[model samples]
Target: MIYAQILAGGKGTRMGNVPMPKQFLALADKPILIHTIEKFCLEPRFDAILVVCPADWLSHTQDLITKYVTDSRVKVVAGGSERNATLMKGIRYLQETFGRHADDVVVTHDAVRPFVTQRIISENIDAVLQHPAVDTVVPAIDTIVQGEADAISAIPVRSSMYQGQTPQSFNVKALVDAYATLTDEQKASLSDSCKICLLAGQPVTMVRGENLNFKITTPYDLRVASALIEKRA
Candidate 1:
């Protein structure tokens, strides 16, 4: 069975002191997370869709699901301490609830990114059939500068760089096995889940993502998203 793990455990630190988490903020008529969940709800490939949020917002998220989504496949879950831990929590839930299998897939996405396209989702589903892991990315348009404390460390080649997006799908058993191999130090430092597969000698396939499929992390992003949503309508 396939699962959709929508991570909504953020505290909105980057959105300049918002009243609520950015995921709960309005995007037109509905919450940002509801729009994100709606995208996956229409996908017939998924057996379960888990909306993982902070423990404090569990019932609130469930209420949002009840009010906004009409499907039974979607359910709200509480997330762990950090991003990766939250992801693992969702994976563990799937394992314990659905029974784990080597071939089962979990498509993990950010709650803020409501514009993930059907094509990107379909490609990830297709690619994960062959590859143990798959990640969504769009080629970087600007020159990437790797710096440390106001000093330039390295200027990477622009053509080779890509900005990562979500729907980072993985084989359930493979991800669980890879995650187990991490040291506490290694696990603490990780921000990307695809790197977990790599640390276990797994090859990650890449699926192209669109620029419009951006994560709404700031007020500027919210404005852009609002405009884009209006335009799309």
Candidate 2:
């Protein structure tokens, strides 16, 4: 039961008062969400491609899919309050629709990240087979700084740090069971779903990602995406 979970729940606050979320914004000839979904649709291994978005925008997202996507694997559902919560919504949907299996894999991705390559997706899917969890990352090019209250708290070694990207794959049943064992405090501490697997003692493997595979958040990123698309054309 391979799945592609596209997380698209945000309100686009950082995108500076847009009429719609960043994922719905046009990137080249299509909406960013459409572009992202199309990438997964190309990979036929996925049994389902779940597009989880804000409840308020559910119909809007569904309409976009109907108009732009020809693939029957794509299904839109309202997302939860937070990213991980949205993921749980997807996981539960998979459970109800298909039931859970220990080896059943789910490759989770950010809907705003339209540039994620097929290589990244394929790597994540392959990594999840041997490990309970997989995270897509690129070697950090800039020195990472940990700060607190306008002051540098710590500076991490650049060589050891990696920037996380999406298409984080996991054994669906393993993640569901591991998530259940977490305490309230542990849940709150999680920055991403892979952390739940880590906190609960499940091993997470890392896959190399491309630098251009970025999440389009700000106007600058949108501009970059547009240019990239034009170049592709």
Candidate 3:
């Protein structure tokens, strides 16, 4: 089975007290999450679309799905406080509802990143067919620096650095086992899913990501997303 686990657990605090979470914000005529969901729905490869939303917004998420999504495969569930927790909840639900397979693919994505292309999603699915895990990444176009307090600590090799993007796919059993190995401390520090695979000593394949596949974190990103949609239209 192939799953698209959309994580929308954030409070949207970075968006400065918006009435709604950033994922629910309208990009044009549709909610940001609807756009994201539509991308996965169009692929025809996903067996089910699972959305993990903040507990308080679970009903609201359902309403959005009812209004915009015609695919009955979409399912909504309450998400946990952190990214990893949210993902764990999602995977557990998948296992309970549909059963897990060693070769099953789960493509976890951010609900706010609506610009993820079908190409990237397909690439991840294809890559994971050979490797147990796969992550999408774009080559860094700028000089990256590691800094502390007031000083630059180190300058990483520009050629080697790649910015990670989502639709990070993994074999169901592989990911579940990786998360099972995480200590409490490591679990609390979790941010990226690919890190879990790496910490478990599993090899992850990298697929090329597009420049437009950026997460909508701040208000500026929302505006840029709007402009991109307009340009596309």
Clash list (residue pairs), candidate 2: none
Write down the lDDT of every candidate, Cα atoms only. 0.91, 0.91, 0.91
The TM-score between candidate 2 and the true structure equals: 0.97
Best-to-worst ranking by TM-score: 1, 3, 2
For residues 1-233, could you state the per-residue lDDT of candidate 3 as single tens digits? 88889999988889886899999999999999999999989888888899999999999999999998999999999998888889989999999999868788899899988999889988888888788899899999999999999899999999999999998998989988988998888877777998898988899889999998999999999899999999989
Task: Report the lDDT tens digits of candidate 2 across residue range 1-233.
Answer: 78999999988888987899899999988899999999999997899999999999999999999999999999989999898999999889988998867679899999999999888998888888888899999999989999999999999989999999898999988998899999999988888888999999988899999989998989998999999999999
- State each model's C-alpha RMSD to the native: 0.9, 1.0, 1.0
Tell me the spans in candidate 3 whose CA falls farther than 4 Å from its real position. none
Model 2: residues >4 Å from true position, as ranges? Answer: none
lDDT of 1 by residue, 1-233 (tens): 78889999988899997888999999999999999999998889999999999999898899988898999998878999999999999988888888977789989999999999889888888888788999999999999999999999999999999999998999988999999998998897798989999888899999999999999988999999999989989
TM-score for candidate 3: 0.97
RMSD of 2: 1.0
What is candidate 1's local distance difference test score? Answer: 0.91
TM-score of each: 0.98, 0.97, 0.97
